[model samples]
Target: MGKMIVRLWRRGFLSALNRGGDPHISDEDLTARARHLAARRHLVAEDGQTELTHALATGLHAATELLEEAGLSRRDARDRAGVAFLKSGQNLARWSMRLWLWVTPDPVGHAKAGNKLAERARMAWGSGLTVHQENGPDHATLMVTECVFVDYFWDAGRSDLTPILCAWDAQWMEIVNASDRPVSISRSGTLAQGCEACDFCFKRKAKLVYSAPFWDRLRGPGHGHG
Candidate 1:
């Protein structure tokens, strides 16, 4: 898990740094920063959530610092860092969903596989994520009472970044459940936003006229019929 966080942080941090347009950040500096992050393997939280939260926060902080050094104001630096973090999360989710689809072959199966893996991970890491699932004919509702990410970030006094992390849940769901029926995730409350719990409602909406397969959509035009 520590190694995984290090790898994720390295990917996000380097991607953000390269795109941040900071003249002072060189190849040598990048290597040094990677080393610095890797050396903090001891910072891995018992629940695994704080480890990832800290890693993402570190990446955002690095981006904000670089942008600030490049003459951006605090607000501008944070905004840019947020964009970079969001892009990194989306890229990671897309890659993960593709890999899951390759293994599971069907979207529903892929989603179930992912849910099982996530549940196992939470149990293994003692993440304390509580959920209630309701299955319907065409949709499912998952209500989460406790989230490790929210708990960790709030405890670490970095609650400001929790929303950024929470945003990845929707991004991942969209990627994994991409379908003609408009699979959607709706959340009303989150622990990060001072709510008691997070309510994730995943539902399949009406089908679209021009819905395309996930792979075709991912590959863009010229690969599938319009």
Candidate 2:
């Protein structure tokens, strides 16, 4: 799983970097280098969580270093690298959103799916991740009051890196919005934005009614009410 992640990340990162005219090594070569860095930093643990999290951090950190060598500032390096990383994972991220749309098929069910994924994250990272969940018949909100990656990058004096992590969550929300599905997801804040928690707000889109006024009829079907 660790190596698999590195491969995907390198694919995205390399693609983005190359598009900017900053050449990158092949994915196979980059992946090998990143895995070595993770191992050297003692970030790979037997249970695999360390590799799952820190190993990617290790790769991103390397990307920053490489970009810095190409004349980018530390902040610029981090922002660019983070963007590349997010770009790399978009397809995989869409799968879950698509799955939820297929499985839940309603606003309430969508909210439940979001709640469950938050709970799953809580279990995956233990203290590193924290989820404060709220669910209703038509809406659900999952807030992350604490996050390991936010704390980690901040402690490393690179709080800028945290937003890249936040963008991953953003991708999921964006996917739902792009779909014609009646359910939509949103967020008002993230720990990266100095909020107390990152909010994942999912609500059912209002369905259009045919029996409404003529003006409403011209407007046709819509996401009902927000």
Candidate 3:
């Protein structure tokens, strides 16, 4: 409805694109959309950090309005908008290029893939993190919760495994617990496809994986950070 509100909506839309959005759009086009949304929100600049200043309450209201306009019920709009912002903020971090990548079949595969990633990450970044499974409320998406807080940076990748990233037959539920503080939890796993069929392909993408401390320090409320 208002210009600022529209900008907020655009930011959410850009986030979806960053998280392996529709395959139809080219990377260049999606980058343009992301920049445009950021510009409208006064979040982009020639130099310096792009920060989100609006109160959470304001963002919540705007997102609710937009979602309802799109035909979702009032309650659904609020929930969806809330999660969208949480995820979009993570997208912003992704665009900022402050995080690294890690891939494995799922949390269960953590024992196998995580230890290796942790070892290399610790050697490279100074800390190691563990993956913890987290369950969501009934209405939210199902996922495996991995905690990257002990010595990490952040995670901004997609949970989908098909067209983008191609991690696995995984579904993810991103958990955003704090606004004033930095936090993100992304979920992924294959519902229809098991790890056997998708394991090899997933490991290949794991090449982009990051060091463990890269994620640990950035993940929790208790962890110390720079």
Candidate 4:
């Protein structure tokens, strides 16, 4: 996840040159593209909602694609994705506090950045931003948020399942993707069968499996079985 964030940041910055807009592509344009892509497949919302508007559709589609491609187990993917969203300037007026902290050492600068990021995230998400502790450095959570935001990229279709699966994983629920049943969780919290479809899932399956006992032990004494 850490590597992915750095990679995305670098790609976003480089793309900004020819792409125009902010450090990343404009969210409006991206949303438009998402709608177009989704429409072609006749995707519909869960409740038979109207097709996505051309204006907001593309950006939503792009966000979804980015998340799906990020692969599950990239714990930080959400936060990083969120940062990228902010960079596009579609959600808020400025970069997030984490961004400021990442770039500078001053606590005040970090606070300012954090407030800006939080404000934008709330605006984009409607409700206040929800925070979750990802299993890595703080940046991991930011990337995960960004990845989740990508779900807006496409209209709901079969593809919508990608985000749904991601959400379950994001919440650390025992749900399975590409399978209908709950995945086997060992005595430890790790999954017995990895989600092969997820890049990170596939990569970390072994390690997670091996660490199951430790994870289980780390869970408070009375926590559910891993």
Best by TM-score: 2
Q: Count the backbone clashes (under 3 Å) in each candidate.
A: 0, 4, 22, 43
Q: Which candidate, 2 or 3, has the higher lDDT?
A: 2
- The reply for model 1, stretches above 4 Å from the true place, is 1-5, 23-44, 47-50, 61-72, 98-132, 176-178, 205-226
| Model 4 Cα lDDT, one tens digit per residue, 1-226 | 3334333433453343224332244445454556577577555443211221222233434553555464522333334444443344321222232232234322222323445434443444332124322222121122123332233333344343334334333332222122222122222121112221122221112222222233344665776234
> Residue by residue across 1-226, what tens digits does model 1's lDDT show?
7668756666765676568565445535544553364354334545466556545555555555566777888677767667667777677678876565544323333334346534644553344477755555555556677875576556545566567767767787676456343355667788777877676655555545325566667788898534
Compared with the true structure, what per-residue lDDT tens digits does model 3 show for residues 1-226? Answer: 2345446645565455335322222334434544454454443222111122222223334444444565777666545544554555554444332322332123223423434433433332231222222232211122322222210111212121112112211122121212112223333433223331112111211313322343444576555322
Candidate 1, poorest ten consecutive residues by summed lDDT: 104-113
- Give Cα distance to truth, residue 121, candidate 1, Å: 6.4
Error of 2 at 182 (Å): 2.2
After the best TM-score superposition of candidate 2, give how far the Cα of residue 36 lies from its true spot, in angstroms.
8.1
- Candidate closest to the true structure, highest lDDT: 2
Instruction: Work out the TM-score per prediction.
Output: 0.62, 0.75, 0.25, 0.24
lDDT (10s digit) by residue, model 2, range 89-179: 7887889667766545364564476477577666556556678788877787877888867866676566777778888778988988887
Q: Indicate the residue-level lDDT of 202 in model 1.
A: 57
Candidate 2: worst-modelled 10 consecutive residues by lDDT: 208-217
lDDT of 2: 0.68
